[model samples]
Target: MLWPYQVKTVPSLPEDAVRLDVVEQRIVPPEEDVVLIAHRQRIVRGLRALFAAGVAALGLLVTIQVVMIVEDRSRVQPGLVMMAIFWLVALVVGYDAAKGMLKPLPRGKWSELVAVPASGLATLGCRIQWPDGRWSDALLSKVDPALAANVFGTQRLWIVGEAFRGATTFAGVPGHAVLGRVRFN
Candidate 1:
């Protein structure tokens, strides 16, 4: 018989699935709510201010390119390149200002979890099967590089897990998103 080196679990077929009560509370967290946990909160006012500034800056760049085209057509190439680069920078900044993309894991008490990890490469994900036959996929995280390597290594290892979920939502909803913390037993 071939040795099994990986475990993959995807909850398919309604009969095999259980309710996501304790974690998602019968509903998967909204994708937007997940973003709140995953990104820094960007106030709308700041984004509006940035939007105004970006428009003016872009206008200036365009005006300079027009001047170059009239003065020396060939010299306009460098101006065009600069405008492209500036436009890219503006796009990234605008997106970040409008919505956060990088945020640390929120501070909270870790809750003990009984879960069977989805095994593979140095990746963060698992599917936990409840006693009632319900299974749910959770994303895993660990701050320590050493510990994460051990648990995420290629070799098989028994895993004990903890979870830190977002306790609040942007839209004032009661439910939250899950971020699993893991350790090898």
Candidate 2:
């Protein structure tokens, strides 16, 4: 019954918390295929680069505004206000992007059950659970109906965030990582 976008407090489980290190040790074998690991690393790096570019663009805009304001004292009032707003937005976006970049992917077991319900035109609702008693309900778009029909309860998925924030893809496999048009509803 967990909705994807609903932010609910997850009560701590009574059992010992699963440490990231322990999970990593158990999941990633020493002799695991280096190619798959390299691919995952590349995905992470690409995401980081995208975030960096966003931050840089924001920074450049702020700098340009500052220069404009400095060059024109008569138009300082509006420019100053715009600069303040831009700076605030840039800081917020930069902070969030940085946090995402720093977060490590956690290993978790995907629940065997998956629910796919039609929401609207070109949209499907999906619910997936984790073995640790966590659930994610998401709205997906542009997904192949055949693939969607077949994928439920089929593969072990790698999750980037607790509430399925970043991306979800089949782990330990190439070309199955990217699901189409995923959005937390």
Candidate 3:
């Protein structure tokens, strides 16, 4: 049954009472979808800005280097440092861009959806879908399990589920992404 109260959770929806089919799951009062969209937009904007800044900084560094080379003959110390910093920043930004490109963006009103199959596994850990939704990474854990038996026998499935719910990890998680449900395959 659809509840009017639930419909209000999704910010994208109009204030009028409405029922939404979120992904494949049918939520009674639709779960709040506000933060996901806002967070996703924020991420996209941040990445775009970082990319622009990185490019601009790199260009400035190059210009300074060129002028220094032409005028002094010997390399300028400060210019070299600045250029190095610029390159480092650019490298970081480029990596971020790659990750953003590879990861799938949030789909529909349910931005937290992730499908991780059993086939993708790791030696030291397990494999999980990346938040951007493009790739999987090894899950480093305290107790490494070789077979599914261990996962199921110990009820560690919950842990696995929790991990799946969380966004593809870089280092840790943020408050907004903390809410997620795990699906077993």
Highest-lDDT candidate: 2
Residues 62-163 of candidate 2: C-alpha lDDT, one tens digit per residue? 676677778986655575467657766876776664553244434443223344444542455666564566667766565544335444435332333244
Question: Which candidate, 2 or 3, would have the higher TM-score against the true structure?
Answer: 2
lDDT by residue (tens digit), candidate 3, 1-185: 11245333555766786996776634221123344445546666777787677777777777777788789977776756667686877768687645643354333232232323243223223344445655453343222232233332332222211334344422111223222222322
Number of clashes in model 3? 3
Poorly placed runs, candidate 1 (over 4 Å): 1-42, 77-80, 85-135, 138-185
**TM-score between model 1 and native:** 0.32
True-structure lDDT of candidate 3: 0.43
lDDT of 2 at 163: 42
Relative to the true structure, candidate 2 has a C-alpha RMSD (angstroms) of 16.2
Error of 2 at 16 (Å): 57
10 residues in a row with least lDDT, candidate 1: 167-176
lDDT (tens digit, per residue) of candidate 1 on 57-173? 777777888887889887777756688578768767767644422333333322223454465433445554444566565544432333334334432222222222332212112
lDDT of each: 0.44, 0.49, 0.43
* Residue pairs with clashing backbones, model 3: 103-132, 104-132, 104-133
